[model samples]
Target: MDLAMLLAVAGLAQTPAPAKLPLPVELPAVANATADPTCGNRPALAERATCVVSTQAGVEGVLQAYEAVFTPQGWLVADASGNVVIYMKRKPEGGCDAFQVLAFADGEMAAPAAPAYLAFATIPRDICQAADPNAAAPAQ
Candidate 1:
C-alpha cells in the first residue's frame, strides 16, 4: 500500500481535523450571546463567547440540526444540563486543549418579540474541562 493508504490504515493520518464545532445557522437580527454571568468575569484565563440564531424552529428541530452539524466535524455530546446540551472535542490549537460547544433553545426568554432563540456557546478547552463533569475524557 502507498504511504497515504498505510497512514490511514494505522489511524495516523495527519489530515487536519475541524478546529471547532460547526456553528448553528443564525436567523435574522441575531443578537450576541453572553456567558452564564455567575462564573464571574475572569477574562485573563479563558475567553467565552456566544452565538444566537432566532427562528421558529422547535426544540428537537434545533437540537437535531446542531447534532448533524457537529457530528460531521467530529464533535460529540459530552453532557447536558437542563435543556442545554454540551458537546466536546479535542482541539489541536491552544496546546492540544479541549474545546466545548453548548447548544440551547428558549422561547420564553425572547418574549413576544423573537418568538424563539437558538443559542450556542464557544468555550475554551481549559474552561470546558474545569466546568464539565463529562470532561472525564476527550470526546471521540
Candidate 2:
C-alpha cells in the first residue's frame, strides 16, 4: 500500500474516545449555618436545630440538631433528581422516629431559616423501617 493510503487507513481505524458524562457532585456545606440561640436553653426536643444539606437533587435536612450532625454517622438517600431523602441511622428497634424531614429546595443546602420539623404523627411508619423492603421485595 502507498504511505499516504496506509496513513489514512490507520487514522480512520483509530476512533476518538467517547465523551464522559460528569460524575454526580456532592452538596456543598451551608454557609453561616450557626446554632440558633433561641433553640438554646429550651427543652431537649425544642432545642435541637435541624441541619439541612441542600444539593442539586433537593434538600435533605437533619433534625435532632447537634453540630456537624451529618458528619461521621448518618444516612443519605438521593432521588433521581439528586434530591436527598435524608435519614439518620435507626436507633435500635425504634428506628428513625426521633428524626424529622424538612422542606425540599433547589440548591446545595437549605437555608438556615428553613422549617425544621415535620409533624411526627404525619410521618409514615414504613419510613422508619430498618430495611427498604420495597427495593428488596420480589417484583410482582
Per lDDT, the best of the predicted structures is 1
lDDT of 1 by residue, 1-140 (tens): 11121111111123332333433323233133222322122221123333333333333454565567667776677765444456666656522233333332332232322323333445434554576566576679
Q: Which runs in model 2 stand beyond 4 Å of their true positions?
A: 1-31, 34-68, 73-84, 98-126, 130-140
In candidate 1, list every pair of residues with a backbone clash.
98-125
Q: Encode model 2's per-residue lDDT on 80-134: one tens digit a residue.
A: 1222134444556555532333333222343444323221111234455535654
lDDT of 2: 0.30
Q: Which stretches in model 1 have alpha-carbon errors above 4 Å?
A: 1-49, 54-57, 92-114, 127-140
Each candidate's TM vs. the true structure?
Answer: 0.41, 0.26
**Where does candidate 2 clash, by residue pair?**
54-108, 54-109, 57-82, 57-83, 58-83
**In model 1, where is the ten-residue run with the lowest total lDDT?**
1-10
